[model samples]
Target chain A: MSDVFLGITNGVLYGLIALSLVIVWRSTSILNFAQGAMAMFAAYLGMTMSSHGLNFWACFAIALAAGFALGGLTERVLVRPLYKRPEINSIVVMVGFLGLLESAAAAIWSTAPRTLESPFSQIYFEHHSTTISLSPFALFQIISALVIMTAVGAIFRYTNLGLQLRAAALAPEVARLLGVRVNRLLTFGWMLSSAAGVVAAVVISSSGSIGLSPTIMDGFFVYGFIAAAIGGLESPVGAVVAGLLIGLVQQFLQDYAPSGISSFAPVIILVVALMIRPQGLFSTTKARRV
Target chain B: MISIANLSVSFGAVHALTNVSFDAAKGKITAILGANGAGKTTLLRTITGLEEAASGEISLEGTSLLNMRTEDIARAGVGHVPEGRGVIAEFTVLENLRLGSLAAKVNFQDGLAEQFELFPVLGERRSQHAATLSGGERQMLAMARALIAKPSVLLLDEPSLGLAPLVTAEMMATISQLCEKQSLTVLLVEQNAKSALKVAHDAVVLHLGNVVAAASAQEVASDERLRQYYLGLVDQ
Candidate 1:
């Protein structure tokens, strides 16, 4: 039961990152291998601000703004010219960007792991003289993830701006013929994606057990990508659901399975999910060309 | 009115269009007829700024369109329905119509009502995804999407492709009616010469990237050499 609660909390963090990846993928048809690194860099910026005597929320706000700026700049400077080029060109560039961000972070912050305490209490709540595994920080993570997901879903589903974004993503040339400004929308999509990534990174680093380092988000990114694939890269709701499922599965395996089996959980689940449903567990349509 | 003068386009060593010149008057249908590789599609694409012309002039109501972006050209009131319908298959009919209304200055509700009145079937299937619509419905939806913007000029490329003859005739009738009622400047590109000549007031025949004949629709239809060679309208 405690494991279930813990898994749900951690699962929301994974879902948040997966949502970010889906945003970028749906808009640009490019898998941002640098997404984790971007989040890490933003969190490092927040940590530095915290060290300078700023409050946690203030630092978080500044970090999110930095992430948004970085994302827009990246799209304009690096990804814009690669549009209509071969798919591999963008992929290679993103992989190169991942290395660049990591190296830059290490050079500036040094190799030592740093800690940033959550604003909320990390200690579990007690009920009837028994400690429940769910902490205030964990609850905050779940709530924040839900809020971000709802906001993003509303933007894509209800608004005129959302319609144009979806149209630009689905048929850019057609959208342009109808007078949609596709280039601007692409940049906006990247900004939103990176902001979501910042949320995930900050939440994960705030967990008491984890230490923040330049590559701290790399493992979470792997799991989030698997969650995105399981959810069908096109659907934000799917990503959240799959992220929760992965969290539950990993928790159960760690508690019940033999020694080293938990480490292979993500890969095993990914293979099984792909084998069962190649289009995606949540996807209604057939696999897209991209 | 839309005009193209001395327009030429090239891909590497191959010339897609060469000195192609024509004028499509307002309130009339001008059919650009040819067989495969006749530059019919290229000419329309260049006007909409999807394809660049090497050296030429394309103007819409006296405003130069040669250097504008595709979206800018659309905002300038040139609505182009490209080959393959270009409807977003994932979007619902209403959503597709709403996307078109983005560029329109008229009241959105009124524009939507007008579209529904013009194409009644679209209203019936407003909630359905475009992918589920039949060949005829998709074509109508594509045209209605362009019309919702109230574009002064409409460029249609291969609207009859893969459609049955009856549906093609019906589409042509609708287009002719729209042009008459709205006084739209229309450039209709088609490989189906027989059907195009039915609605066209003027016609231009292209063969090997050059205009072979330019005259009234009746004259082009009557010319035996153009009918047999350029349009493939006669049995050789």
Candidate 2:
């Protein structure tokens, strides 16, 4: 039962990470592998403030803001020139960014990893023989994902700015002629996508998940990628659903064989998903008109 | 009125247009007819800022178009309906139309009812995704979308390409009537010389990226040489 709860909670975290991937991917068509690194940078920045005696909430707010800036800058600078090329080139650039970001992080902060405290450590809930921990930081993770996803959907569907961004991604030349100010829209997409990353990182880090080098972010990145791929890259709802399912699978795998290699769950799910339907489990099969 | 003087452009090594000069009179449908790769689309796009004019001056009603960005040019009033129906396929017909209006920020003029009235079939499928529409319906949507922009001059590139014969005639007639109704200047580019010549007040015959013949639509339509070249056996 505890394992069930653990699987469910962990699934929720991975689901959030997948949602972040979807947010950026749909808008820019760039598979932002560096997204995890950007999140780590924000987390480290947040940690710096927390160590200086700031409250958890303050650190979180700072991290979210930094995420927005980082995303906007990367999109405007690093990714802008690659817009007309095949999307694979963008992915390669993201890998380069991952390396650059990691090195920069190392230069700023020593290579030593540090574990932070969960804000809700003092609070605990128990039912019968099972122990359930509802950490405030973890709650932020679930809630932040929900809120950001809703907001992103709302902006894209209802706002003029969102329409412009959609236009720029789908038909950039048309958007430019329609006065969309496409460059600005691209920058904004990066900002929004990165902001989600920051929130995800803060939530994950707040749960005392930092100090686990590469493991902290890389695990979540792999889970998110699998979730997004399985869910259908074209649909945001599909991404979230896949993320949750993968998270649940990973959670239960840990529960049944507590000593098993937990990292294999996502890979297994990924293989099964690709072999079954490479277009994604939930993607709509659109016919070619011309 | 739009004027292009000494306009020249090259794609790497190939010169597409060299010193092409012409004026599309205001409130007139000036049809530019040519064979494929004659640079008709290139000329329209260059005037509208879609393609850069390498060395030239473009002026709309005596206002300089140089040094302005494409978006700025669009905002200033030049709507282009490119080949293959430039409608955002995933968007609904209504949404596509709304985006057209937002291009220039016109407060309010023609609404959905007007669009439906102009193209009844489009009105019927206003809520449907534009991708689901027939080729002809998409053409109507494209024209109507550009019309809503209230552009002083409309740049239409192959509006009837890939459409059925009956649908093409219907679109041509509708486009002709819309031009008269709106009193809008139009720069039309088409390889379908017959339909283009039928509605045009002025015609420019382009050969090898140069304007070989410039005359009234009637004059160009009646010319024996151009008739033999474009109209062929169909010329009466």
Candidate 3:
């Protein structure tokens, strides 16, 4: 029973990371392999600020803004050149970015993982006989994920800017004809998704000691990618739901199955989910040509 | 006024347009009639700055359009309704209209009420996404989008393609009225010879990327031999 709760919580975190993946994929049709690294980088920035005894809220704000800036800059600089290239080329560029950012963080911040403590650990919830202390990290992770989902959904449904952003993704030539200022929109997309990644990183980093160490983020990247693929790469709601399911699966597997095998549940589910619904859980049957 | 000289585009071995040359005078509808793959669409694309011409000079209103960007070309009074209408599907008809208005320097938001009179169907569907629009409605929205841009020259490629005869005729009438009302210079590319000729003031016939004939619309329409021989259609 505890395992179920644990898995569900972890899955929510994974869902946030998955959300980042889906956001990038939907906008540019490029799977950003570096999204995890982007998250870790922002977390590293927060760690630096936090180590100086900065307040949690301030660190969070700084780290998140940095996320947006880094993402926007990356889109405008490193990734913009490959925009006209094929999807494979963009994917390769993302891989390169992953390597470069990870290595850069290591060179500057060292291979050591940093301790990122949360302020909300004081809160507690008793479930039956077991007591679940709602750690600051978990509270932030769940709330932040929900917030990201709502904000993104609202923008999509209610705002002209959101509609324009989506139109550029679904039909770029048409968007251009409408004079959408395509370049600005691309930067905006990167910033929005990258900011989401930063929020995920901040929440996740608080759970464990993570350093400027790139490998500290490697596991979450794997899990996030798996969650995203399982949920369907294109749908935001699909990714979140898939993330929660993955979380539940992981917890149950860890509790019941051998500890070693449980670690690989996400991968197994990833393969099965992809095989069953290649388009995604949420994607409709209608094939979109553009 | 629009002029293209020495316009050519090639996809490796196959040449799409080989130094295609033509002129569409101000306040006139110049129709280009050619079979599929005859570089008709390519010509329109070249004009719209979608394709880079191998070497050419495109001048409009005494200004060189050479090496101009597509958006800039659009801003500079050239409106292109590409083969598929190029309507942003996720945007509502009103949003789509506003977007087109945003393309030009002159804001058309104030003219929305008046413009609705021109495309009442779009007015009725002001809040619906363009994706849900029917084939004819989609074509009308596309045309309305360009018209709202208030362009000096309207470049339409295969506007009547994939539309029913009645719908096509309605589109033709809308375009004719637009040309008359706006005194708009239009470059229309169509394989449908009869209707294209009916609406055009001048016609440029192309066969395999070369201009086979260029004359007044009345002269070309009256030439039964030319219609049957060059255009591949008999007048009703």
Candidate 4:
């Protein structure tokens, strides 16, 4: 029972990360390999600011702003120049960025993992003589994820800016003909995605004493990639739902299945899910070619 | 007037367009007829700044458009309805129309009323995704999307492709009507020379990458050898 609740909370965090990847992929068709690195970098920035006795929310906000700046800068400096080249070139560039950013984080913050305590209490509740996994911080993480989901949903579904972003992502040539500043929109996509990654990092770290390291987000990045893939890489809502399902499956396997077998659940599920529904679990239409 | 002088474009070892030059007079429809690989689409692409010219120049009202970006060209009052309609299938018709108005730098609200007036069917299905639209509806949406920008020069590429004869005639009529009403300088690229010549005031025929014939639409329509040999038009 506790494992199920744990899975849900953990899944929400994974979904947040998956949403970030989906945001970038939907916009540029490039799986952002540096997403986790960018999130970790921003998390370290928040850690540094908080270490100086800054307000927790203020530091978090600052970290998100930093993520936005970094994402925009990376797009303009690294991604934009390579855009005209073959798609493989952009993939290589992103992989290079991933290595550079991880190394940079290590060089700056050292190889040692530092403590990153959540603002909320980590104490679990007791109900019916059973230990439940719903901690104050865990609940906070779930609510935060929900809020982010709702906000993102509204932005994409209702706003004019969202419409422009969709058009730009789906048909850049057509969008350009319609006077959409596609270059700016692409940059904006990266900025929003990185900011989402920052939120996921902060929330995920706050759930427990998962000490921060240069590669602290490696696991999250992997799960997020799997989650995004399950969603078919085009649907935002699909990514979140898939992330939650993956978490539940992972938790069930860990609690009941053999320890060794549990590790392969995500891969097995990914393969099966892809084979069955390549478009995604929630995808209503096949992705339109630009 | 939109003028192309000695315009040439090459892709590595291949020249897509070679010294092709013509003028699309203001308030007139200039149909560009060609066979496949005749550089009809390439010419429109170059004028819209989608393709870079290796040599020569393009200017609208004496303003040189060389080295200008596509957005800049669009901002300079050039609207392009690319081949395949380029209607964003994911977006609704209203959103597509809104996107076009973005290039015009005007609020779409004012233009939306006018667009709905021009194509009443579009109004009925404005909220529907472009993918759901039929071939004819998509073409109308493409034209409406381009026209909403209120461009001084409209570059239309193969608007009649894949549409039925009646739809093609209606589309051409709408285009000619728009040109007459707006005094729009138009470069209409089409493989349907018969339908195209019916609405065009002037015509340029291309063979390979070079202009093979340039004359009035009637003159080009009347030349049996040129029409038969180049345009694939069989005289009745």
Tell me, by DockQ, which candidate is best. 1
Candidate 2 has a DockQ of: 0.65
List pairs with backbone clashes in candidate 2.
A7-A251, A11-A247
The residue-by-residue lDDT of candidate 2 on B53-159, one tens digit each, is 78988899999887777778888888788888789987888878878778677643455567778888988898899889989999999887877778888888998
Q: Docking quality tier of candidate 3?
A: acceptable
lDDT of 3: 0.79
Please provide, for model 2 over A99-187, each residue's C-alpha lDDT reduced to its tens digit, 9 standing for 90 to 100: 88888888888677755455665344566955575545555566667777678767877877767777777788877766667788888
Clashing pairs in 1: none
Rank order (by TM-score, best first): 1, 2, 4, 3
Comparing candidate 2 with candidate 3, which one achieves the higher TM-score? 2
Kindly report the interface RMSD of candidate 1, rounded to 1 decimal: 1.0
Task: Give the clash count for each candidate.
Answer: 0, 2, 5, 0
TM-score of each: 0.97, 0.93, 0.85, 0.92
Cα displacement (angstroms), candidate 1, residue B215, comes to 1.8
What lDDT does the true structure give each of the candidates? 0.90, 0.78, 0.79, 0.86
Clashing pairs in 3: A7-A247, A11-A247, A113-A211, A114-A210, A114-A211
Write model 4 residue lDDT over A96-165, tens digit each, in one string.
8888988999999897887566678878988898878888888888898888877776777787777778
Model 2 Cα shift for residue A271 (angstroms): 3.2
- Candidate 3 residue-wise lDDT, A1-290, digit = tens: 55665666677778878888877776666678899898889778877898788987888888898899988998888888987887778888889989998998888888876656677663456769677735555666677788887787677556767666776777777666556677788788888888888877777666663423666667877888888776767677878888888888877777678878878877888777656776667664234322
lDDT of 4 at A178: 68
Using TM-score as the measure, the top candidate is 1
